[model samples]
Target chain A: MLSPILEFFSSDPKDKKLKKAVEHIIGQKPSNIMLYRLAFMHSSVSKETVAKGYKESNERLEFLGDSVLGMITAEYLFKKFPFKDEGFLTEIRSRMVSRESLNGVARKIGLDKLVEYDGNRRTVLARTSMYGDALEALIGAIYLDKGFQFTRKFIVKSILTQHFDIDTVVSNNPNFKSLVIEWAQREGKQIRFDISEEGAKHNKEFTATIYVDDDSFAVGQGYSKKKAEQTAAMKACEKLEIS
Target chain B: MLSPILEFFSSDPKDKKLKKAVEHIIGQKPSNIMLYRLAFMHSSVSKETVAKGYKESNERLEFLGDSVLGMITAEYLFKKFPFKDEGFLTEIRSRMVSRESLNGVARKIGLDKLVEYDGNRRTVLARTSMYGDALEALIGAIYLDKGFQFTRKFIVKSILTQHFDIDTVVSNNPNFKSLVIEWAQREGKQIRFDISEEGAKHNKEFTATIYVDDDSFAVGQGYSKKKAEQTAAMKACEKLEIS
Candidate 1:
């Protein structure tokens, strides 16, 4: 029962280019045809087939893949940076899992080669998050077909260790919010955040004040509290001349 | 610095009787300090840590964990239930990660034992999503502390396999949206979703109609697409006696 369904989704074995690409990227012959199919299935096809009580898209797979990626990424960070605390680990994980990074990885893996679409190029172009979404879906599919261990190995070897630097990436990107608070407490100062007004309602602005005991030493404003604090901290760092 | 901090968080080692209860329920030693902390870090923590230099709480962690939990749960369903398709996998994952399920886990693990606040308990009670939020944060922390294999082992062995069955869950809790769409299409129907009026400009009410070709089978209303669809779908489901 599953054989013909698998055959329907699988690329022809004779398609040398796709086969080679799959072999190079996945490092083995494809065993799970439905996963590959789900990775490339578009929502339009899903909508049509959904009416027939037959699911036809990668959305579910994408949802599954997202978790797998996060778990694998978290695990990798845990072992790689044992000395770092939870806050430090979290910042690094955020950068690694950010939409920009995920999209970059998807493009590097030549995922564009496998995309099956039925619309104008503009339509595909408009759906920018498609790459990241599909990549996540593919990871979900891989985990389903193979297993957690295999998925973790594939993610570590293919994505984390290969494409990104562990230390340089994290250390350079310290959490500004944490730094600002640390500096305030160390100098025996009080800090105030006034999110009174800035930006539109959807994008509000915040202003932060760093006071050394009784006097305000620095002030900064930005779209988010973290950004505002970073600005304020950078200003205070200059005034304190701690470096 | 780190040792003292660890001691401060983990001292008392979770009361012996309570620990035994948690072991019987969650089936593991507390995975890591951050997981325990996150389970208690309420949004009321004001988003700024004097030591950490930021005003953000575990909200971001909760966001990341929510998506990650969804993905991993979906993959678990996919592998465990080979006969089940995308819809079934989605339904099972939804149930596993639902607010109620997460709250049940949180209560079982004695998350309330670690809260650090002195506000009206009713205010805390109102935010039902907090339970799921804490659960996700715990997962995120575990992934950071333990790594992929251990985290996977913990989640699968401790949570899903121990507490629930995938097939029964999916068969019982069919997604209302999917069911409605399937039924509408089978009966040769068209659905129209219209935003009739918005409340306060910020909060909006949407109306959705499930039409059998041209005849309206069901009409429902809500504040968001998902909510509106669920309402419409529920109406259609009850009308058709599908479940």
Candidate 2:
């Protein structure tokens, strides 16, 4: 086990830039570099797996890593704010794990150089989620290769402790849905969110409108209905000066 | 480290019902009974922690275990349905992890006997989600006691392989929101979901309605807007005979 782990990490003893960088980023020597290799494999390339019936992409790992990341962050917040209710914890969690937030964090951690997407990396459109997905895949790879405790430690030492300020995150209010509803109730007005799917199957966009007393107050769009509703609520809050 | 692990598992030389049941369920000697103790602790009896200003409940563990469970299931589904898209994967996952399903699985696995919630176990109203939360806590405990590999094996062998039929879960469409929208679109009818908050801050209930061509068609309620939308969609589907 030791021999294979070391050999895999030191395969290119002459030039181990990827391995060295990965080790530095994750704060440990790589056990199975192949997992890390797959972490860098973007869906665009979608390289075929050595396993006969498998296609290798970071998507599955991304999905896994997403949950891992959420758990770590949830644990952190749960400990830091012991008195905070579930709603507050959940809202802050959303802000911390949002695509925009993750994208920014990925860039801050210099994941742009490590990703393997099959497109120009410099385009503004491509930059929308440039390294966010790869970062998640890396977390998944680390979880798979290192285990949960090690992954949790990496999230704490490498990501949270080093990259993010937990205090700022906890202090901010991100639950616009609650805010708009509260405003509506206080003013004795009824508010409703009308959400509908409006796009292609794979890239479906949901449109949500915040309706005040059967009239449209604000409109917002997102990849999912919940996301669209949140955006729409934020827009309504802003429009009504309640934000 | 090995000695300490062994000692922790074997410390309680007496009433080892918890340890025995856990060992039997997990198919291995638990490394830490303390973790299992925390797993059985419901919020009603939230024991204070040794850590200053910290309270111990199964909540944090539940949060962690949820991610562990999600990751394991996601990996399983990803492998099983390599051709399926993200939407399909997400829909199938919901069915597998729904409260109703979890509750049933928990009862089937005898978590009812192991859980330590401070309530009458015979009450039907209290049975709404008695064992599901404890089941998650148990998974979290197993993860903490034996680590991710052990947890993964336990989920696969003890839970999925022994308990659930993956084929049935995959084949059934659980995303009523999607189904209702599809049916409405095929019929050229304008469909909308009106989601609004109702009730107290802590005991908040969300109400959702399915509107077809500006007419109220169905109503559903849940703890969150997304769940409310889903319930409303399911009701609409049933009402229109599209489900």
Candidate 3:
């Protein structure tokens, strides 16, 4: 029923195909098809408009969607763990919305197929983060086409429940060092961690500085070497905008 | 009429005053008066519950409100400047929600009087940022009490429009160096900038590192000394979570 209605909205075969794909992914028909169309338009393929420095791309939508996603995740975690402190909630939210997590979600939902980008561009442009970014843009499109309530329901019901196992994510302890190493290996980048200690033996503090491809990325400090390394890895992941 | 109704809802004089104040500030009566009371709870005056680690305070609400405010600001900027790129929108939004800006808004709306905190504690705790934080917590409470649409309208109509002048914010050029210096003075922290230049004189690049209170805060790079310092100041501002 939804497919036929979507098909009736657009006679163009390409538009019909896009509408069907969107409906299939989001479990509903988009009110404004153009917003979803714009959401899928990566900057690589986006053409500059009449105004100089302005181009029709998903970047703006991605910006908006990022905030929307953050709010929803924050609220969900706030209610889910009633007794948890802000630090714990913040940590969990970051893990959930991490680049690796979003990329996995995007792939699982078959969003990679809908993303339109320049095929001839550098191979690195087709990296995993692109899928995650497109997922965010798609969320922005949903938010605009429908209001916040509908978008929140869609994200909570269709996206979070469908793609993410909340219990598993909450229970599993994240090892940032391992996560960063895995990312480095996949991206074929050289990653190194340097540690230094200071203060007395009884109260020594370790500082870890992370370097990617020989350029310093970020640094973190902890009481133990492992803790310091983990902190550094976490910071590096944030700085690299990976995981 | 509203005051008499609020008095009728609460027999306690303190509760009546609080309700009247909240109503006056937000332009509406709150459905859950307890939420508003929780929003004003400062950690300095907060008592831990029987749950041990869990405390009744506004920190959790602050965390939630921060995201709600972020999304509302992002959407507001997204719609207001359709032609502006994401970067521009981000900068302006940050400026609007900056510690200094929010503090000013909180004071303008007389939120400082409503914030509950330990009066005998360190004078720093009663500084400008507390009002800003309380403002955010109030926003979070409003979100939880009235839902997103009502909160959005309140933020736009009562808060944003009444407090912020959008045109002045957009037109003014931000000087990060000055901003950071002012913050350092206010916080009574020792601030220093170290710079290094490399490459040919014709195409030299400058790197600036900012240290606050004798600790390295952040670093930035640019084509000139002033630009490098400005960039460093901007990064330091973000690291310190100040304007």
- Tens-place lDDT per residue, model 1, A167-227, is 6776676445567677778856677544345434554557777665655667776546766
TM-score of model number 2, chain B: 0.67
**Which 10 successive residues of model 3 chain A have the least lDDT summed?**
A1-10
Q: For candidate 2, what is the recovered fraction of reference interface contacts?
A: 0.35
Better model by DockQ: candidate 1 vs candidate 3: 3
Residues B16-48 of candidate 3: C-alpha lDDT, one tens digit per residue: 888899999888887888788888988667765
Ranking by TM-score: 3, 2, 1
Q: Tell me the deviation in Å of residue A15 in model 3.
A: 0.8
DockQ, in order, for the candidates? 0.14, 0.19, 0.49
Across B1-243, the per-residue lDDT of candidate 2 in tens digits comes to 335456565656542888898787778877778777777776555644555434566766776677678778877776777665343565577678777888888888888787776564347436556577778878888877786788888888877767788887766756789999999889799998998884446545578988999978888765568877887887676565554
Ranking by DockQ: 3, 2, 1
TM-score of each: 0.54, 0.63, 0.74
For candidate 1, what is the lDDT? 0.63
* Fnat across every predicted model, in order: 0.21, 0.35, 0.81
